[model samples]
Target: MQEDSPLTEATSDSRGASLLTSREPSPSDHSGRGTSRRSKITRKSHRKSRAGCVNCKSRRIKCDEGKPSCANCKRRQVRCEYPANPATSAAASGLVDPREPGDLPISEIELTYHWATTTCHSFSAWPAGVARVQALTEEVAMKNQHVLHLIFAFTALHLAVCRPKRKEHYTTTADYHYERALALVTPEIASLSPDNCDAVLQSVQMICFVSWARGPQAGEYLAFGKHGRSDWLVMFRGIRTTLASLSRDHFSKTHGPNTRGKGRLLPPSDGPFEYEKQLMELKEHIEFVSEPADRDDNVNSVEVLQEMYSNRYGGKDGEYHVAFGWLYRMSEDFLDRLQRCDPLPLIIYAHFVVLMHDLEKFWYMKGWTHHVMSGIYEALPIEHKAYISWPMARVGWIAP
Candidate 1:
């Protein structure tokens, strides 16, 4: 509830009496009347204090006594404090720090709540609401929690797109939540091997998104206590290790073929082995393309990359089409350059070049890529020739 102002009421009365007081008063009397009116107005104006959440009030150096906590406290994930008699308590406890006039007073409780509510509160709230609906077992409750954790982790992943600096804190929270989520999901996985299914898929996706969104964090987390990009590389390397483990137990049940009661299926002799080899090829190619390069390759040049991007593969018909279908759009030459370029440096440089409009320097150093590719196009097979040239011809119009 808002407090009424004593000064406002007193001011109205003073205004009403102004005409009477002005009627031929003695000079001394007039001065005394003026002083009295001023003092009364000051006291009325100063009466009753403003209250806010401890966090907000401390930040504002005002009393906060509203909804257990103030808006700022809630937003910042800080603790909120509500003293019994806020005004009296503030004065007695010297809550107001004179030295740092700008400092806000936020209680620990308010901060914690602020962080929870602002960040993962919505996600965490889901498990609680879900647990009560169907008499959930501890295992089931944990699974629900896992879903909530995935939700929170992805939420953090999305946030990383905009708030890159907060990646570390968000990552920490996400992984801790992930472990709990994994505990819930693992039993289901163990029981139903390959059919480990949706919950597992989501958890894996969350891990992938988190790693992709904040690559640096993946590096740090996987390293135990070690530092650097090798750990980051492990993000992919580790995928293989995981697959190796999965293959040992669940490969046959989940995949085609039943080797039950037969001889053991060795790595290279099995179909799954071949599939894994193909997967590894793709993984290796990705790692290679994304690796750092000291100089610009043909793929890195804007004109050549743009040509590669504009080219599309046709289906069975001999129509105008580019290969790899629509899904592989980024798989084009320009993207290849990005894939080949050291993502860390290239992304930063791209941002700078974009911000500064350094197209002149960009083209000057890389423009000849088109000329080089023109010769390579001539050597292509007849079918490939048409696809390459048409896209190349249109490159002038499609300025990068």
Candidate 2:
């Protein structure tokens, strides 16, 4: 190679200087000035953040330190909690006293007991298995985060619905615990273990209750609107899928020895139950009525009304399928009318509430039937009162 070019020589010298600076300071270079300058530059380049909300800190992002909520969390719509300052923050927020029992907060314990006694009994629809909810509540709920959060969420929702004066406070508390349980349990939904299976199933059930509790008119109507109906269906489907997974796993474990070495086994199919047949009929009726040319408003309306009662007491599985099924099967125009609290739709909905009474085995539906019926009664006009007489009689409401 020819004599090194000035540019190449300069590059090599700079690389050597970079290498020297990266290494620990050597005694030969220790005027202390070079080391101090390098350290200062390094510190400036890799400064550690000393203040920010916990969410921003955990995410390793810069925070604008907004009060109540930081900019980062506001953008993401996540809870922004700051690190507790022993001096000022704790006192301002009315932090729980350290002397209070730490095992379970007194308020939480009270809510759990309330759920066990009142809420548990209300949702247990099956007569023979009613005690199971109470057993699970007492045995597993206290120690399990998923179940505990569900209990708190349910209790708060119940209070919110039953005690309107304190609805906001109870709703806020319910949302907090619901979010916590959802965050913890969502990841494990796909890979449920035997240890967590029961909690997951129970959480699904409680989540269903939460959905119902927050439903249209505070769990009164079938929540037929687009926003409420789709969300409720999603949660209902989640419960169905989770239950199916649990059943499949249990079957696999039970038959594993006999089926050893068998390639991945498929789940055994149980044919549709009786209620499913009625559901199919209802769907067929809806399809017929929805046809452009074949649609007869008078005939279609009559057919739908009849089907509502045909599946009113939803075969053996309980009334939820039929109760919600009717709401789901209705045409968009009908649903819109229902959402607007129209008299005819309210009358129809009140009949569905009659079906709900038979589902009282479910705690969430205990007072719902009466509450919805009362709302219909209040909203129905005098001229339209005659139209709802049959439904009123069915729900045991004597018209004034």
Residue 352, model 2, lDDT: 57
Backbone clash pairs in model 1 (N, Cα, C under 3 Å; residues 3+ apart or in different chains), count: 33
Compared with the true structure, model 1 gives a TM-score of 0.26
Clashing pairs in 2: 122-362, 122-363, 123-362, 123-363, 124-361, 125-361
The best candidate by TM-score is 2
Candidate 2 lDDT over 302-381, as tens digits, reads 46545654544323233233445454455656655666666555655664565566555454555656666766777678
The deviation in Å at residue 343 for candidate 2 is 18
All models: lDDT?
A: 0.33, 0.53
lDDT of 1 by residue, 1-400 (tens): 0012111122255322211111111111001111224643543222112434434444565432334444554555433444344344454444532212333333212222332334322221133332221121111223344544544454554444445686555554455445556677667545544544433434443454344344333213221212332332333433333444454455433222222122121112111212233323433433455434522432233322233223311112111112112212222333333334333223212211211111112211123223323323433444434333323433331222
> All candidates: CA RMSD in angstroms?
22.7, 19.9
CA deviation > 4 Å runs, candidate 1: 1-75, 78-144, 160-202, 215-235, 244-400
Best-matching candidate per lDDT:
2
